[model samples]
Target: TDQVQEVLEAAGKVYTVLKIDEVSNLGAARIRVRSLLAALKDQADREAEAAADAAAEKRGCPAACIDLNNLDKLVPASFTEKADGVVAAAEVEQREGASTEFERVQFTEEMRDAGYTILAPQMAPYHFELLVPIFKRAGYNAVLLPSVDHGAVDAGLKYVNNDICYPSILVTGQIMEAVLSGKYDTDKLAVLITQTGGGCRATNYISLIRKALKSVGLGHIPVIAISFKDLGEDNPGFKITPKMLYQAIYALQYGDLLMMCLYRTRPYEVEPGSANRLFDYWMDACKHQLQRGVRQSEFRRTVRRIVEDFDTLPLAGEGTKPRVGVVGEILVKFHPTANNQIVDVIEREGCEAVVPGLIEFFLFGIAGGIFQQPIGKSKKSALGSRIGLAAVKKLRKPVNDALEKSARFHPPADIYELAEYAEEILSLCNSMGEGWLLTAEMVELIRSGCPNVVCTQPFACLPNHVVGKATIKELRRRYPESNIVAVDYDPGASEVNQLNRIKLMIAVAKANLAEKEAEARAARDAARDGAPEDPEPVAEAVEVETTEVAE
Candidate 1:
């Protein structure tokens, strides 16, 4: 009886806190109740839609928002062939299928033989799930193991002596969580860590991982340091097989294509899960084709077929819309972590959401270095410039090709001019780091027809806060009618708060678009300008905030 009383007390308090209706009149109270019920109904509908999308994703069709079916095979067979050596090593380990100790010894030996260079903070498109595919495509026989999570964070808290970055903790936590999940075998498993050799405590992440292994009594496992600093592996040499590179690049290209398709289709889908269903089918097809050695010509043919297939999807939305561009920190902008599904929110609001590919992040990072060093073009700096430019062209070529071939989808001009357009922006925002670059990108997005830009970033991320917050004023000043908003994510933030902010931003964007169209109409009448009239106003957008945090 006492326990029941206690439970009732708790429930009552909860209801009291949530029931914020302070209407003084019966009419006001009725309106408030009706609005609340309507909001609840809308939420339930969205949940049902998401659930339907998830189901469609499971059914091996395209995801309602994205498709991966037909991407140009970005990585050629040659790259996979080159990665054969690495695969051979992993095969040997599996074949030896020996005890954990033996496998560890073998792995160590292989690492030393190939001179496995660990890239510090070695982050990639596919962290763990896609590592095998990436390695296979890259023609490398490498295994990516999650490093110490809790241990690394604890170590960082102790010795690294730096303000804790959320990524570091999340990465660590993800590893730790995976470890505890018992899905991974720590034995014979060598976790790869990147040591940047920089001032950032990020350099210590590897050491922390090592320490973590020891603390967890998993010290026997090898810690492979993937670095660009010519770090030597004594136990074994590490080599990249051509195949792994091919798979890695292909996977990323496919990911990009999928992202692009999803963004394009989502804004006006009739059936909620249609885009996602196609994505699943496309992934399965890509995997199968890669395994079967599909002909290059056939590959293009397959993509065309898939695009035709997607185009045939009967899904339709309510209205014509303005496409908005979303650009910001890579994780926040793309990951639900930072933006709380801002892209989806924008789409739901009856607008096309354009998110640039991950390649731009890489391009910006490289360009940042060159701009930072004025002497980059000198004889001594010639090698760096050559390398940077080569990388830019190499990475950009496929993207450019994809865009060129895309009939239904056209990437914004800013994306085509990414490397070239980034130069001046880099110079102007050097003080703000990559955040400033992201802001500039968002600004460029607005300038290039995406009247609305949303900068998704972590709350209190110094670079992001400075760049995102400060650049808004400049963006609006330059593009007076620009609709811009920065959504911040942190552990304790409420979904309601986040959604409310985004809704407000979208409202402003809608208002601005309306005013612009009105002005254009007025101008059209005055000048008899043969220009076409403006697009009509869209229905109010439905904004939902559901950003997932590591916790």
Candidate 2:
């Protein structure tokens, strides 16, 4: 055991497990091993960064004053004047000699109190619309950038490297396009992006945006990166507080529940916008609840009300529409513009669009630490992850419970169960971009009576290309009735080609629905006539139709 441990240590591998029962007392050892690993990794980096790294370790977001007396004379009246909760604005000074980790941008501590117009690219519209309000309540003035146009893509192509995934291009494009459009004050502008800190190229998106900004002579604009990993002191003023994190989690739960309910009832509403009207009402209500700083009880009540409101949408004459599940890379799957309005496309084809909740993607990420337990550096880190996951699941209980109780809705609740399901096909440790989660979502979608699915992939996303498009045949083999179409989204991807593929999938789904209905009718008739129902003949007609659609 000592020799093995020595060998493992030499390889820079972590093994915290000894006796299994030792894991039972995490409170006794709450130290974070991941930080130690990060420190080691940082030290091994280029020696030129040594001084900057040392200064960063000791740096902190300073307590700053916010008053019109310190503010610029030309500052806008609404911004300079004190708001209900915020202090009067102060002049945010550009700091000298900050670590230009990305490029030549310097973000000072004063920006935290300055309330810069944070332009965050809209990923999930429903989620962000609900979420940004919570962020505002947490003291960050965040705005979800409106969907990008052709100009946005063109801007991205001109500024950002064209070789990356479609999402990066689109995201960069939106930010740059917004900046170039002169809609906001350039001096008081910032861009917010999430960094997963994973092996995927997405970890470097902040740097890409910074580089793009530098290329456009706007390098002074701070790129505020939202990362769970601690980026040392030479950074932006924005940081995630515990309260902010808590509020954000609830916001996401609301987003997921709302999204699930909206898609569930929208396609079947008697009035065209009945479901949307309900959604709009609930959105404001939930946003208010989050803004006012409610406890879990209020959140639970709000969820129940949300579900109840959506339930009242008065569904149209629906024997049943073929439900199409949309699962893919986080951005493209949720952002309508990114995937050429995929949910709308599915809805237009007379199908219920079932997008698995955003919370599930977050769960997959949180579970990654726990997934690494076997080879994890410290049992405490694994314990922390498990505890975090459990807490999130606990917070999510109300949303799931509300969803499950509703006659009109039922969304997936358990991440562990999902892991177990996905483990059948691929190892959970293979956590890259989407990785096993994509395959798992497709599986869950099919198993939950929604067999028709659309897997959206960014044209150049290698991880998704492997896990999503590559897993389709195997998924079909497992669930023979599943009608799946993988659509790739790129700056130059053909919408017509995508539509044709989707139309083909929908045709198959329609044929499958027809066969099932015929089988049911035949069963009823055979029972009345005291004869066994023959479903094979019923299947033949649909099969012929499917072949024609294929052709």
Candidate 3:
């Protein structure tokens, strides 16, 4: 009773203690507990709905007044004012047409064939490195831009609002800096940005890029929007064909496999750069195969060869080492520049880094559409989302199968399984940026034997705060042995402070690992001596009853 009361207090749930006589037997006590929990859950739900209603009212947009069907038409008046300085100028340029000598040029199929270069920002080096070769093979002069740096951040800050998310700033800055550097012919170069078409501010990134380009007197250079949705409907020239989409998906899967292999082998390799060299070899081989128009049937063979190659690398002495899993915002979690090379830092600290596969994110986007069906009025919209998800799953099977067959790598969890893990803790309807997917990744990491997790989020991502930070206490309650820390990355945040916190987590990981090893050694020695083994005392498990609360 005391333990249950303490847990309720810690979770911030208000409950009155029941007299012992009032709950006379175990069954009666259980019934009382269930009733109290139900009441608390109802109270929480009511409060959450009231808060949401209040927020909507304060914003002066009634729930019914906002059209979910068309997100572009629902921009509030206040948002328009905040974005006017940037968006208005771009809109003026767009309406003026190229006859007025506007700098922005649309990238047509003709431009692609005419040797026009397209630059894409680099988020994950290994993934982008492999992905670039596929683009080259497809006859698109696509180049992954250089790593983000202080210069990119400065350039981003100059044109972009500082209050915007850090990734937007870095992406805009990297492109603008590249353009101004005279690295490519101004007439033939274009920049590509992704449009999520969601409620999050990320949907505004394409607009931000256009505004920045116009401000820099480079409005003539086309800003291509790459998205699965109809957000880029106006850009007919930058269309993605079925073959191109198929190839890109395979490239992403291959990149994920290589990244996993690299992280698993690099830390303990006898030669410092052998794993990297082999990685480059496989990348080149895969690119050549892709160029030759290798059939999907050959993908499994390719995966096997790549795994066999990595297996040949000489590894140094290794026992169980500290394993740290990284989960957070897409850009900061994978980009070295954004997170200050966190994976490298973890490796340097003698730990193996485990990052979830990028395919999971694509799956998350598909899942989001399905999750939102309940809120939408159109059955057609729900049907479209179902069809889209089914097609993606069909396409994903070969890649998943290949990974599962590989002996040296860990297979990614099925999308449904990930969603199930998330459903256990968070509501499926919470489809914000990353949303339930972030929580699912944390659960996946803990279950996969990497309990020490570093959740890296940009300083201003609100979705991350709700899904990442807010869910940690509940996660800890369920997995008491989890060693987790949330690290915020921003221009103003101190690197020293981030590193210090990570160091502390690492210290705890090392101690726990040492203790486990000691216990194993003791058991083995006792068995070898042919003497009566001392009985090991078992620790009592603490039962923490918790109700799922949506944020």
Task: Choose 1 or 3, whichever is better by TM-score.
Answer: 3
Q: Model 1 off-target regions past 4 Å?
A: 1-107, 110-131, 136-163, 193-204, 211-215, 219-221, 225-238, 241-243, 289-319, 337-339, 348-350, 375-402, 405-407, 412-416, 419-436, 516-551
Error of 3 at 76 (Å): 47
Could you give candidate 1's per-residue lDDT for residues 101-121 as a string of tens digits?
A: 212322465553454432222
Q: CA lDDT, every prediction? A: 0.54, 0.79, 0.78
Off by over 4 Å in 3: 1-105, 377-407, 531-551
True-vs-predicted CA distance for residue 208, candidate 2, Å: 0.7
Candidate 3, 450-509: lDDT as tens digits: 889999988778988889988999999999889999999887789999999999999999
Query: Which model scores highest in TM-score?
Result: 2
> Model 2, stretches more than 4 Å misplaced?
1-106, 233-236, 374-378, 528-551
lDDT of 3: 0.78
The positional error of residue 337 in candidate 3, measured at the CA in angstroms, is 0.6
Cα deviation of 376, candidate 2, in Å: 4.6
